[model samples]
Target chain A: MSLQRPNEKLKSDVLIGVGLRHQHFTEALTTPSNIDFVEVHSENFFAQGGATQSVLAQASEKYAISLHSTAMGLGSAQGVPSQYLQKLKQLASTCNPILMSDHACFSWSQLNGQQVHAGDLLPLAYSEQTLMVLAHNIDRVQQSLGRSLLVENLSAYIQYSHACMPETEFLVRLAELTGCKLLVDLNNIIVTANNINAAQPLDYAQQWLAEIPTTMVGEIHLAGFTEVKEGELIIDDHSQAVSSQGWQLYRSALERFGKIPTLVEWDNNLPSWHTLVAEADKARMIAEQVFGDNHSSKVTTAMTGLESEFIHE
Target chain B: MNNNDAKKHSLQAAFEQVAQQQQTLISAIFPSADSEVIDEFDPRGMAIYRNNLLATAQQALAISFPTVLTLIGEGLFNYASRELLISSPPKHGDWALWGDDFPSLLTNLAQLSDYPFVADIAQVDRLRQQSMRAKNSVIEQASLQLLATHDIDEIYIELTTSQFGLNSNYPVIEFWLSHQQRVVSDTAEELNQKFIQQSLDKLVQGDFSQKVLIYRPYYNAEIRELSASEYAWLTLIKQGVSIGKALDIMTNNNELEHDFDFAQWIGIALEQNLINHLKV
Candidate 1:
């Protein structure tokens, strides 16, 4: 397979992509399409061999691929494993994704004096100490990749009482320190808000979006959440269609972030390929509406901010 | 202290605090005999994370060992997976690399004592997964010329690393492949059931000892059964024995069929990608 360089250009116009799942590989590869890019879990293709690797190569040719990893453990005090980063570097060198991201969480830690991967994205405290660790690890990753990385806010089940700052402030500070950008998942904001029993989750999420500088967010993620009954936690399961509230948050995010590269991620109980693409189409149409109505102030400021050398190519 | 020194001191303090808390949480999740339960975390939140971890482990293992899950069902699989997770918890983040010890876990579990063949089936599944995830390598077709130019004693046959040999007393390939068939149609499901029944019958008859070869010539891993002679011959070839020495060893073995033909075996091995290259 050819190790061609991925398209690094971040479009100033509205761009939408779908998560290219293994089940939808044939349809995505064979069909005539208008989707701008495809995002895949980086760990799934780390093997770099077999049919999985072949399908990823085919997807890379068809669309601008995003390498979103789940296990980079960017906030772990133990730091990212050299072996894991080496494998990721090999995959990145081959696939050459346009964007790579992981959560502001830690999955690697020592248990009973033995290093272990928790196999789940464990939440990190939003403190100066954690920020230093996150920045140190992100710097290590960026230095290894010879490119910038994106750190995403997680939908955490538990919030640390000792956290010194808001999640948005923490992420913005992370970008400032590491020269990385943010993948602001709108669904995660809403899910986290609802889980924390925020009286108005949509309003909370909108405020959360307003805190980050427009240029710091390079990409936006729109996904669905599974809401439980009273006395249960709302899950960022990505099982259903993007909620109407999620769309509203997307609109709010667009009004602020202004036409960033967005992805519609439906991981569980996956819809058909056509149905999945429709979600991306919805995101594009919504972006057009958001930018069409408020083109002067939001668009211009976001454009001016993004045009600064840090966020733009 | 200087500004940079102060920042470094704070960072070290933070690392220690975060590391201590994380280790505490991890110990709670994968508790050992020496584990001390820290009461600082909320019980409800801890339960959510614990459930999520176990669920993730189950899903990951199910992908690697689908036949084992199918045979034992989810309830038992969850129990055994949880047991395995606490004992041999994934050293790395990749779940695919985490379950190499699952077959041994199955063999040692008292709950699965009645189904000993399940362990062997799991062994085959692990090898199949390894074969699928192994680095893709190309056969040195140029080295085939060595077989023709050199004498039998002077030439060594090399097999691809993707090839694995599993010798099971149970009918593993038959039992495993019967489940691998995609029963898309009702008729296919019936045929699969029939094949599974036949295999079970052979399994009960107690002479179904088989040697299984999982070979990956290209992308997908394929499982095939080998006769005693072919397996013995391949085993010798894998031990870096010369073609003549392997043949001589196979011929002298009373347990193996003396009718082992290197000419036919070479043709079959090359076609199946069992032979990587011929070395002199």
Candidate 2:
């Protein structure tokens, strides 16, 4: 299987991929076309030798594989675990992912001489001390992996009262300090905005787009979130179709960032492969409209096949 | 307070305050309307976190106890899970090790006490999960050949990789197997002493006592149920017993009922890769 390098340049138009789940492993291997990359959770493939690993290996040969992690726990007070880093290195050496990404939240905390599951991507107090800790963690991760890691912004439910800075500023400062890229998950920003009752969705998007270094935006994530009550949004629910608001945010993001690779995540209640492909087609249309033709040759080649058959005559 | 001391004091104060506000903070994390908090916005915000925590806890429990979840419907299982979470929340960040005490928890629940075998089902479910994720030492090919020469009767043997032990008075395995055939309709009240006695009678006469080795050699979890004769044989092998004495014990006890074939049983064990090594 061909492993895409972390530093490899992406095509101009957003290349769309789905979060590959075990249920869809067979479908992913057999079905082809229009998907620019395939992303899988790193922990799922931690098994030594299994059907899951075999399927991932097969898919990697055909498509660009991006390894997204949930266990890195970059913001942990105790710091990153060396064992996890070693396992990640082994996985990277085996899979050769395009970009390795983890959430900006901590999953572990010290308890009774053992680290216990915090059960949530916990929100951290944005202070100078936290900034330093986060920078050190990111630096260590990059140094250990021998490549720059992309830290995705988190979808928070509540804001810390003592937080001295906004999340956007924290992310920008983080990127500047570590020389790492940012993975702008548009759904998370919307969820954060709703939770805090802070800014309008478009205003938040515009501010983030203008402030963040566009060059450092390595990828984008588009997912569906369900609203359980007023002013509360659950990001990545995967229950319904992508909301119009999310698509609008994607369009605005495309106009601002200019055609980075995008991903459509359907983790729960995953529909048929064709259903996801259809969503990818929508993203392709948006990409074409925003970036135009003169982007990357690979994307152009992919587009030509998809456009003539799936999009236009 | 001095500058450094003041900073430390304030941080400590902040953390204490946050911890003291557990209800509010937990509500923010899990958000259930059923909480004692009176504020409308508190419940709304709290419900989001409540649902999130519940859903995540439920997912962890489901992964750890797939067979248990299969036996009980998702709704009842989820309802039972809430009680378990309240009693014992996850202490670690890894969800894989979350539901360790669920079987015991189920056994103690007053609501589920009627379903006497629910806990045993949970035990099997937990073992299945452990078998899938637990680490095991790999055995070499040469180790199998050396076993034949050793005096198996003189030594005690231990299962290197596959280790699933169960000791119960109730016929839990049989009940589990029966439930798989169809949905269980008997309520706790309906499950009388007479039925229990009848089942126990069947169990003793029909070779109810058994030992099984559960482990993951390649990828998936495997369960190999052992008969009384085979159990004795493996136990002798495990004790570092010489093959001759082990067979002698088996012969003296008349453990093997009619048509006893040692070669066939050994072949099955070899094919299953159960024999790890011989202890000299």
Candidate 3:
């Protein structure tokens, strides 16, 4: 199959795949339905010769791969590890992923002349200095990989006291300054809203959608979150089913932002392959509902070895 | 406040301050605290941090040490994990590489110390991980041809990069394999040492020290359980002994039969890509 361009607009019906776990690798690769793209965790494939690379190579021949990362630590004070970035770049070159993205959280804290693995993506303060640090990091990442990186907003539990602009503005400014696209995770927005006691997260989302340049939004993420107690909700929990409220918010996002590449992430308590496909089908249905049936036809065209020009305006 | 510097310093300071107070910080975000932060708009903010921290750490441990998690059910595993985290917090950004010390931590647990196999299982788990991420090397077919030049009784052989040596005092490998056959049923019951000793004796013939050759010619890492004699033969060969010298030692010790098919064994090793290069 011919390679597609990164800047090309994917069809509205396009449903991107999430990281494939060992449990679902066989089913995912052999499934009868045609998936538009397959995403993988960069760290999972760091091994030299393993089943992960073998399966990914096979899958790449059949589908477009998106190399998503969990350990880039792009926003850390110590900055990105050179070895990790080099390895990731090498993997990207070999796999030929369509896009690369990582969380906007810092996980590293320098201590005693060593960069230790903190095991978690800690929250960051939304300030100009932090923004500069992020921008420099993003620039380095993009330059090193020779590809524009997409930074996904993390779901945070705490907010800093430093007076600053809203997260939406911060992200928009970062994208504007660094020339990186946004991977708008609707679940994170919902989680942040619940954490902050925002009366209307949907409205906040709409405002964000309006403020951020639509062209800069490369992809969207939808995941389920559970309500721990009464009013608090955690996004991207990787457990439970995607709530209707989140789906509704997604629909609203589609209406405002138009068709964008979307992924359904069920990382933990992952169900069978059929369950994941069903979730993807749900996302596809929403896509069709907002963008019309012609969207799927275009998607089919792209799947059957057609050029991007055929589907794009 | 020159708009830029003020924003940068203030935000950095706030984050540093918040991260310092782990408990109160989580309570502030999560609002799951017994009481709410009345002054701030974000009440249950800390709860998010707490949940994320615990959940991420739990998930990392769960992935790294599946056998331990399985031995203890999810509830108890979570409890043990929480205790472990409080004592030894994660110090890095990579979650996958996190919990490198979890196996040792579990071994030190007074509750878990009775099961001597737990630590060995952890060792096996780490070995599996190392095998997965180990560097790639190509085995040479020419290396096997050297075996044909010398008489079976006179040659010393060597192993190459495609091989891995695992030395263990316990039947950790067998324990892991059996545990994989069934989900751990009860954590409250004490391990039966007599039954374990019998099984270990049958597997190792009362030999506590054994050498296993782990090599991956293709995709999966294959473990070949070697006898003490075979291990010695392989070790000498791996140390660059000429094929003739290695075979002489094996034959002198009666470790090899007169009719022992050296060619067939060499062929199998070649097919498995265990041979990399020849010294002679």
lDDT against the true structure, each candidate: 0.83, 0.68, 0.67
Classified by CAPRI criteria, candidate 3 counts as: acceptable
Angstrom error of the Cα, residue A132, model 1: value is: 1.4
Segments in model 2 whose C-alpha atoms lie over 4 Å from true places: A1-15, A48-50, A110-115, A227-236, A294-313, B1-43, B70-76, B86-88, B134-163, B181-208, B215-224, B235-262, B273-280
lDDT leader: 1
**A190-260, model 3: which lDDT tens digit per residue?**
77776667788777766667777767787888888766776655555767666666787777778777767
On residues A1-313, what C-alpha lDDT tens digit does candidate 1 reach at each position?
1113435423225667889898999999998665778999988988847889899888878887899999999999999999999989999888778788899999999875788999988899888888888899999999998889888889888778889999988998899999998999999998888888899999999889889998888889999977699878877789999988888788778889876889999999999998888777667666766677323122211233322321221
Q: Sort all candidates by TM-score, best to worst.
A: 1, 2, 3
Which parts of model 1 have CA positions greater than 4 angstroms off? A1-12, A293-313, B1-10, B31-39, B181-208, B252-255
Instruction: Estimate, for each residue in B1-280, the C-alpha lDDT of model 1 and write its tens digit.
Output: 9999998888898888888877877777664545456756767777788888888899999999999998899999999888887788887878888899999999999988888989999998899889998877777889988877889998998788888999888887777877766557887678778868867887788566888899997878889888888888888888889999988888788887798888888778777777778888
In model 1 chain A, the worst 10-residue window by lDDT is A294-303
Instruction: Write the number of the candidate with greater lDDT, choosing between 1 and 2.
Output: 1
DockQ of candidate 1 compared with the true complex: 0.70
| Angstrom error at residue A72, model 2 | 3.0
TM-score of 2: 0.78
Q: Judged by DockQ, which candidate is best?
A: 1
TM-score of 1: 0.90
Candidate 2: clashing residue pairs, number: 29
